[model samples]
Target: MKICVFGTGAIGSHLAGRLAKGGAELSVIARGSQLAAIREKGITVRAPDGELHCMPRAAADPAELGPQDAVLVTTKQTALPSVAGTIAPLLGPDTSVAFVVNGIPWWYYDSEGGPNQGTRLPQVDPGDAMRKAVGIERTLGGVVWSACTVTEPGVVEVRSPTSRLILGEPDGTVSARAQAIADILKAGGLGAKAVPDIRTELWAKLIGNLSQGPLCVLSRQDMKTTLADPAVREAALRSLNESIAIAAGLGIKLEINAEDRFARSVNTAHKPSILQDLEAGRPMEVAAIFDLPLLLARQAGVETPTLDLCVALARQTAAAAGLYQA
Candidate 1:
């Protein structure tokens, strides 16, 4: 199958290398130094398993790559508007567009069914650009468990011992298209699955982001270091409980033990991606990873006091740095 990976950052580059190694006809939409490096040296991923190197077709314009069987959008939420404007050239009649992003997706309410069905997240989508560009019929929900970073242009370092990608249809059906993409990712040595409940997977990952991301940004330290403080650890536990409560209010009860989760996170040395962006002076995912969850909590009438405080401070930090406006 032919696949195109949009936004060849850390996660995108890692997935692109896997797709190339998996023997799919692969291509990438990239820009700046990363694009030049990929065109010159392909993509190099230093993973815990081993080093992988592959050169897929690299282009700055989506039109240059044409339509594909599938397109995985690995860009941050901040870039989605621009992607929507340019992504049309890469979609075919039956092509699937999987948004393998963090936090709550913009398509969270589409096909969700019920009173909240069709609700729009203007913060994430901004004028329904993505909804119009990639219709729900061709959209897939994806969640990835990979702690990675691009050490240099076209080269990524995977810090996690294991990485996995989960894909599913928004309407909760196991479709052939989602399975095909999962198979390609698995063939490249990454653990990939096509599940029936992608939203559950999303909330599970999001709970971790909520508990760790804001604190890491405030402390300016990695998870292991920041979470080592007992006081902060307790706060994190409260945040975790509140996040789970928010999810439960949304009708998705996540079976996560706060202590057990922190026990594992306290050993992780990698910094959260939002912290990385703040340090690099790039735009952080304040709205998607932090703000949106709080918004959902308010909508569900779930109180998230600990999360509210941490997120407020983190948002201020981002805004003060001129990275985030609100």
Candidate 2:
């Protein structure tokens, strides 16, 4: 398979390395120092299983890479609008575009089949740019459980002991294309699975994000440190329960133990990405990660009191730092 990973950040670089290791024809769309380094030294991933290094074609423009069997978009939500505008060159008639991103994705409602079916999240998609650029037929939903960081240009450090990528079609069917990608990722030593219900998988991962992200942002600490306090741990558990309630109200019953989830979070020393964005002066994903979930909660008639307070404070912090507005 010829694969192009758009945005060679931490997750993108890791996926690109895996694809190259799996014997796929790989290329990456990157920029700045990262692009230069990938072009010069390839990509180095320090993972738990072992070290991986692979050199693939690297460029700043999508046109340089041309079309591919698949294009994995791993950029932050803030960059999606730009991606929509510039990604035409990477799409062929049969090409698949998987948005391996965080928070509620823009394609969440395309074939959802519910009260929210066909509803568009303008905050995430912004004028249906992605909907038009990458049609639903070519779209795949992705959720990743990799805690990664770009330690240096072209180098990524995977902090989690286990990393997995879950891919699925939007309309809740097992797809051959998604399975093919997952197989390649698995062949490269990363855990990958193609699921029937991507939304349930998304919410399963999102439960952890909801429990840790906002609190860590407000406390300015990593998950372990932020959740170390007994009181805060309890609050985190409450937040997790509330998030599960929201998911339940949306008709997805997540089989998660709030205590177990919070316990795992207390052991995770890595900082959530939203906090990382705030410290680096990048735009925090307030709208998608924090705000949209709350919107869904309201729509589902689920009250997220802890999330409400923590997200409000975190939003203010981001706004005060000029990283977010509204």
Q: Pick out the ten consecutive residues of candidate 2 with the lowest summed lDDT.
A: 256-265
Clashing pairs in 2: none
On a 0 to 100 scale, what is the lDDT of residue 72 in model 2?
Answer: 98
Per-prediction tally of clashes: 0, 0
RMSD of each: 0.8, 0.8
The Cα error of candidate 1 at residue 259, in Å, is 1.5
**Every model's TM-score:** 0.99, 0.99
Kindly list the per-residue Cα lDDT of model 1 for residues 228-289, writing each as its tens digit: 99999899889988988989989997788777887899899999988999999988889999
The parts of candidate 2 lying over 4 Å away from their true place are none
Model 1 TM-score, 2 decimals: 0.99
lDDT of 1 at 43: 96
Best by lDDT: 1
Give the alpha carbon lDDT tens digit for every residue of 276-315 in model 2. Answer: 9999898888898889999999998998999898889889
